[model samples]
Target: MEVTPRRAGMVALLALLPVLAFGIFRTWWAGAITLINVLIIAVSLYLLMSPTEEEAHEAHADNGVENASDEAL
Candidate 1:
Protein backbone atom coordinates (compact mmCIF):
# COMPACT_ATOMS: atom_id res chain seq x y z
CA MET A 1 0.00 0.00 0.00
CA GLU A 2 1.13 3.54 -0.73
CA VAL A 3 2.05 5.51 2.36
CA THR A 4 -0.54 8.20 2.50
CA PRO A 5 -0.13 10.83 5.18
CA ARG A 6 -2.58 9.00 7.40
CA ARG A 7 -0.78 5.71 6.96
CA ALA A 8 2.55 7.37 7.58
CA GLY A 9 1.22 8.85 10.77
CA MET A 10 -0.02 5.44 11.86
CA VAL A 11 3.39 3.94 11.16
CA ALA A 12 5.07 6.64 13.19
CA LEU A 13 2.74 5.90 16.04
CA LEU A 14 3.41 2.19 15.71
CA ALA A 15 7.14 2.83 15.88
CA LEU A 16 6.64 4.96 18.93
CA LEU A 17 4.49 2.46 20.82
CA PRO A 18 7.23 -0.03 21.48
CA VAL A 19 9.60 2.62 22.70
CA LEU A 20 6.96 4.05 24.98
CA ALA A 21 6.13 0.66 26.37
CA PHE A 22 9.77 -0.08 27.03
CA GLY A 23 10.21 3.20 28.79
CA ILE A 24 7.15 2.78 30.93
CA PHE A 25 7.82 -0.84 31.81
CA ARG A 26 11.59 -0.61 32.18
CA THR A 27 12.18 -3.59 29.89
CA TRP A 28 15.56 -3.62 28.20
CA TRP A 29 14.53 -6.41 25.86
CA ALA A 30 11.56 -4.39 24.76
CA GLY A 31 13.93 -1.58 23.91
CA ALA A 32 15.91 -3.86 21.62
CA ILE A 33 12.74 -5.11 19.98
CA THR A 34 11.58 -1.55 19.54
CA LEU A 35 14.81 -0.61 17.84
CA ILE A 36 14.45 -3.49 15.41
CA ASN A 37 10.83 -2.68 14.72
CA VAL A 38 11.68 0.98 14.11
CA LEU A 39 14.29 0.01 11.53
CA ILE A 40 11.82 -2.26 9.74
CA ILE A 41 9.09 0.37 9.81
CA ALA A 42 11.45 3.04 8.56
CA VAL A 43 12.41 0.91 5.56
CA SER A 44 8.79 0.02 4.83
CA LEU A 45 7.75 3.65 5.04
CA TYR A 46 10.54 4.72 2.73
CA LEU A 47 9.58 2.10 0.14
CA LEU A 48 5.86 2.83 0.44
CA MET A 49 6.37 6.58 0.14
CA SER A 50 8.92 6.72 -2.67
CA PRO A 51 7.69 7.16 -6.26
CA THR A 52 7.43 4.03 -8.42
CA GLU A 53 8.16 5.68 -11.76
CA GLU A 54 11.24 3.59 -12.49
CA GLU A 55 9.42 0.37 -11.75
CA ALA A 56 6.50 1.38 -13.93
CA HIS A 57 8.79 2.24 -16.82
CA GLU A 58 10.65 -1.03 -16.42
CA ALA A 59 7.41 -2.99 -16.49
CA HIS A 60 6.29 -1.30 -19.70
CA ALA A 61 9.71 -1.80 -21.25
CA ASP A 62 9.62 -5.49 -20.37
CA ASN A 63 6.20 -5.87 -21.96
CA GLY A 64 7.46 -4.23 -25.14
CA VAL A 65 10.36 -6.67 -25.25
CA GLU A 66 7.99 -9.61 -24.89
CA ASN A 67 5.60 -8.30 -27.56
CA ALA A 68 8.45 -7.72 -30.02
CA SER A 69 9.78 -11.27 -29.51
CA ASP A 70 6.28 -12.67 -29.98
CA GLU A 71 5.89 -10.82 -33.28
CA ALA A 72 9.16 -12.32 -34.54
CA LEU A 73 8.00 -15.87 -33.78
Candidate 2:
Protein backbone atom coordinates (compact mmCIF):
# COMPACT_ATOMS: atom_id res chain seq x y z
CA MET A 1 0.00 0.00 0.00
CA GLU A 2 1.21 3.47 -0.82
CA VAL A 3 1.78 5.62 2.24
CA THR A 4 0.55 9.12 1.67
CA PRO A 5 1.91 12.05 3.66
CA ARG A 6 -1.05 11.98 6.02
CA ARG A 7 -0.57 8.28 6.60
CA ALA A 8 3.13 8.78 7.14
CA GLY A 9 2.49 11.55 9.65
CA MET A 10 0.13 9.28 11.53
CA VAL A 11 2.70 6.50 11.55
CA ALA A 12 5.31 8.92 12.81
CA LEU A 13 3.02 10.03 15.59
CA LEU A 14 2.45 6.44 16.65
CA ALA A 15 6.17 5.77 16.59
CA LEU A 16 6.83 8.93 18.56
CA LEU A 17 4.48 8.01 21.41
CA PRO A 18 6.79 5.31 22.74
CA VAL A 19 9.81 7.52 22.50
CA LEU A 20 7.97 10.18 24.42
CA ALA A 21 7.00 7.65 27.04
CA PHE A 22 10.57 6.49 27.33
CA GLY A 23 11.64 10.10 27.62
CA ILE A 24 9.17 10.66 30.41
CA PHE A 25 10.28 7.48 32.19
CA ARG A 26 13.95 8.44 31.71
CA THR A 27 15.05 5.16 30.24
CA TRP A 28 18.64 4.74 29.12
CA TRP A 29 17.47 3.77 25.66
CA ALA A 30 15.22 6.81 25.53
CA GLY A 31 17.93 8.87 23.89
CA ALA A 32 18.47 6.32 21.16
CA ILE A 33 14.73 5.91 20.62
CA THR A 34 14.29 9.68 20.55
CA LEU A 35 17.01 9.94 17.93
CA ILE A 36 15.16 7.49 15.73
CA ASN A 37 11.97 9.42 16.30
CA VAL A 38 13.77 12.56 15.23
CA LEU A 39 14.74 10.87 11.99
CA ILE A 40 11.20 9.67 11.41
CA ILE A 41 9.81 13.12 12.10
CA ALA A 42 12.30 14.65 9.71
CA VAL A 43 11.37 12.18 6.96
CA SER A 44 7.68 12.73 7.58
CA LEU A 45 8.14 16.47 7.33
CA TYR A 46 10.11 16.05 4.13
CA LEU A 47 7.42 13.85 2.59
CA LEU A 48 4.72 16.27 3.67
CA MET A 49 6.51 19.35 2.39
CA SER A 50 8.00 18.02 -0.81
CA PRO A 51 6.01 17.34 -3.93
CA THR A 52 5.15 13.74 -4.78
CA GLU A 53 6.99 11.80 -7.48
CA GLU A 54 4.22 12.40 -10.00
CA GLU A 55 4.33 16.11 -9.28
CA ALA A 56 8.07 16.37 -8.69
CA HIS A 57 8.76 17.08 -12.37
CA GLU A 58 6.31 17.47 -15.13
CA ALA A 59 6.25 14.15 -17.02
CA HIS A 60 7.08 14.65 -20.71
CA ALA A 61 6.95 18.37 -20.03
CA ASP A 62 10.57 19.04 -20.95
CA ASN A 63 10.92 19.91 -24.63
CA GLY A 64 14.52 18.72 -24.82
CA VAL A 65 13.78 14.99 -24.69
CA GLU A 66 10.75 15.33 -26.92
CA ASN A 67 12.78 17.25 -29.47
CA ALA A 68 15.46 14.58 -29.56
CA SER A 69 12.91 11.79 -30.05
CA ASP A 70 11.09 13.75 -32.72
CA GLU A 71 14.36 14.19 -34.66
CA ALA A 72 15.02 10.43 -34.51
CA LEU A 73 11.52 9.62 -35.67
Candidate 3:
Protein backbone atom coordinates (compact mmCIF):
# COMPACT_ATOMS: atom_id res chain seq x y z
CA MET A 1 0.00 0.00 0.00
CA GLU A 2 1.28 3.42 -1.00
CA VAL A 3 1.23 6.15 1.64
CA THR A 4 -0.16 9.44 0.42
CA PRO A 5 0.93 12.86 1.70
CA ARG A 6 -2.30 13.32 3.65
CA ARG A 7 -1.97 9.91 5.29
CA ALA A 8 1.66 10.61 6.16
CA GLY A 9 0.72 13.95 7.67
CA MET A 10 -2.02 12.33 9.79
CA VAL A 11 0.40 9.68 11.04
CA ALA A 12 2.94 12.29 11.95
CA LEU A 13 0.27 14.28 13.75
CA LEU A 14 -0.87 11.22 15.68
CA ALA A 15 2.70 10.71 16.88
CA LEU A 16 2.62 14.17 18.44
CA LEU A 17 -0.57 13.56 20.40
CA PRO A 18 1.28 12.17 23.40
CA VAL A 19 3.46 15.26 23.59
CA LEU A 20 0.44 17.52 23.32
CA ALA A 21 -1.33 15.55 25.97
CA PHE A 22 1.67 15.83 28.25
CA GLY A 23 1.84 19.56 27.73
CA ILE A 24 -1.82 19.93 28.54
CA PHE A 25 -1.40 17.89 31.65
CA ARG A 26 1.56 19.99 32.82
CA THR A 27 -0.01 23.44 32.30
CA TRP A 28 -3.66 23.88 31.49
CA TRP A 29 -3.39 27.34 29.86
CA ALA A 30 -0.55 26.69 27.46
CA GLY A 31 -1.95 23.28 26.65
CA ALA A 32 -5.33 24.76 25.85
CA ILE A 33 -3.77 27.27 23.49
CA THR A 34 -1.68 24.59 21.86
CA LEU A 35 -4.70 22.40 21.36
CA ILE A 36 -6.68 25.21 19.79
CA ASN A 37 -3.78 26.14 17.53
CA VAL A 38 -3.36 22.57 16.44
CA LEU A 39 -7.04 22.25 15.67
CA ILE A 40 -6.99 25.43 13.59
CA ILE A 41 -3.98 24.19 11.64
CA ALA A 42 -5.61 20.83 11.03
CA VAL A 43 -8.80 22.45 9.74
CA SER A 44 -6.84 24.81 7.50
CA LEU A 45 -4.85 21.91 6.08
CA TYR A 46 -8.03 19.94 5.43
CA LEU A 47 -9.51 22.88 3.55
CA LEU A 48 -6.36 23.42 1.52
CA MET A 49 -5.94 19.75 0.60
CA SER A 50 -9.33 19.24 -1.00
CA PRO A 51 -10.90 21.03 -3.92
CA THR A 52 -14.66 20.70 -4.07
CA GLU A 53 -16.70 20.50 -7.27
CA GLU A 54 -18.52 23.71 -6.38
CA GLU A 55 -15.24 25.52 -5.90
CA ALA A 56 -14.07 24.42 -9.32
CA HIS A 57 -17.27 25.55 -10.93
CA GLU A 58 -17.10 28.88 -9.13
CA ALA A 59 -13.54 29.40 -10.30
CA HIS A 60 -14.52 28.85 -13.92
CA ALA A 61 -17.51 31.13 -13.52
CA ASP A 62 -15.36 33.87 -12.06
CA ASN A 63 -12.93 33.58 -14.96
CA GLY A 64 -15.77 33.81 -17.46
CA VAL A 65 -17.07 36.93 -15.74
CA GLU A 66 -13.62 38.48 -15.78
CA ASN A 67 -13.20 37.75 -19.47
CA ALA A 68 -16.57 39.25 -20.24
CA SER A 69 -15.68 42.43 -18.34
CA ASP A 70 -12.33 42.62 -20.14
CA GLU A 71 -14.06 42.40 -23.50
CA ALA A 72 -16.45 45.18 -22.46
CA LEU A 73 -13.56 47.47 -21.44
Candidate 4:
Protein backbone atom coordinates (compact mmCIF):
# COMPACT_ATOMS: atom_id res chain seq x y z
CA MET A 1 0.00 0.00 0.00
CA GLU A 2 1.28 3.38 -0.97
CA VAL A 3 -0.28 6.79 -1.48
CA THR A 4 0.65 8.82 -4.51
CA PRO A 5 2.07 12.26 -3.79
CA ARG A 6 -1.11 13.86 -5.06
CA ARG A 7 -3.23 11.79 -2.70
CA ALA A 8 -1.01 12.62 0.27
CA GLY A 9 -1.21 16.31 -0.55
CA MET A 10 -4.98 16.10 -0.82
CA VAL A 11 -5.16 14.31 2.53
CA ALA A 12 -3.06 17.04 4.16
CA LEU A 13 -5.31 19.70 2.70
CA LEU A 14 -8.38 17.89 3.96
CA ALA A 15 -6.90 17.62 7.45
CA LEU A 16 -6.42 21.39 7.50
CA LEU A 17 -9.92 22.14 6.21
CA PRO A 18 -11.60 22.41 9.59
CA VAL A 19 -9.08 24.95 10.84
CA LEU A 20 -9.46 26.96 7.68
CA ALA A 21 -13.23 26.91 8.01
CA PHE A 22 -13.10 28.03 11.62
CA GLY A 23 -10.88 30.92 10.71
CA ILE A 24 -13.12 31.96 7.87
CA PHE A 25 -16.24 31.65 10.00
CA ARG A 26 -14.70 33.79 12.71
CA THR A 27 -13.31 36.52 10.52
CA TRP A 28 -15.10 36.51 7.20
CA TRP A 29 -18.46 34.62 6.94
CA ALA A 30 -20.40 31.46 7.79
CA GLY A 31 -21.45 30.38 4.30
CA ALA A 32 -17.89 30.05 3.09
CA ILE A 33 -17.04 28.00 6.12
CA THR A 34 -19.94 25.63 5.52
CA LEU A 35 -18.88 25.13 1.92
CA ILE A 36 -15.35 24.47 2.96
CA ASN A 37 -16.49 21.88 5.49
CA VAL A 38 -18.45 20.02 2.84
CA LEU A 39 -15.50 19.99 0.47
CA ILE A 40 -13.16 18.85 3.23
CA ILE A 41 -15.41 15.97 4.24
CA ALA A 42 -15.64 14.76 0.67
CA VAL A 43 -11.91 15.00 0.14
CA SER A 44 -11.21 13.36 3.49
CA LEU A 45 -13.32 10.36 2.55
CA TYR A 46 -11.20 9.85 -0.53
CA LEU A 47 -7.98 10.24 1.41
CA LEU A 48 -9.14 7.78 4.07
CA MET A 49 -9.60 5.18 1.35
CA SER A 50 -6.20 5.84 -0.19
CA PRO A 51 -3.28 3.55 0.66
CA THR A 52 -0.32 5.08 2.55
CA GLU A 53 3.41 4.48 2.29
CA GLU A 54 3.70 3.73 6.01
CA GLU A 55 1.18 0.98 5.69
CA ALA A 56 3.07 -0.48 2.76
CA HIS A 57 6.39 -0.38 4.60
CA GLU A 58 4.88 -1.93 7.70
CA ALA A 59 3.38 -4.71 5.63
CA HIS A 60 6.66 -5.39 3.89
CA ALA A 61 8.54 -5.42 7.18
CA ASP A 62 5.97 -7.74 8.74
CA ASN A 63 6.26 -10.16 5.86
CA GLY A 64 10.07 -10.09 6.01
CA VAL A 65 10.05 -10.83 9.75
CA GLU A 66 7.60 -13.65 9.25
CA ASN A 67 9.81 -15.19 6.56
CA ALA A 68 12.89 -14.86 8.74
CA SER A 69 11.13 -16.50 11.66
CA ASP A 70 9.96 -19.36 9.45
CA GLU A 71 13.48 -19.88 8.13
CA ALA A 72 14.86 -20.02 11.70
CA LEU A 73 12.18 -22.48 12.74
RMSD of each: 5.4, 5.2, 6.3, 7.6
Model 1 spans with C-alpha error above 4 angstroms: 1-14, 53-73
How do the residues 1-73 of candidate 2 rate in per-residue lDDT, one tens digit apiece?
9766666666666666666777777976765778686777768675776576776566547655556657888
For model 4, the local distance difference test gives 0.67
TM-scores for all predictions: 0.43, 0.44, 0.48, 0.35
What lDDT does each candidate get?
0.71, 0.68, 0.67, 0.67
lDDT of 4 by residue, 1-73 (tens): 6776566657656646676667666765664666577667757766777668898877777843456557888
- Per-residue lDDT of model 1, residues 1-73, tens digit only: 6557456746665767768778578878778777777867777776677658997777777843457557889
Per-residue accuracy of model 3 over 1-73 as CA lDDT, tens digit each: 8554476457546635865876867887777677677766766665666678897787877843456657889
Output the number of the TM-score-best candidate. 3
True-vs-predicted CA distance for residue 11, candidate 2, Å: 0.7
Better lDDT candidate (2, 4): 2
> Candidate 3 clashing pairs?
none
| Candidate 1 local distance difference test against the native | 0.71
Q: Which residues of candidate 4, in runs, are more than 4 Å off? A: 1-28, 55-66, 70-73
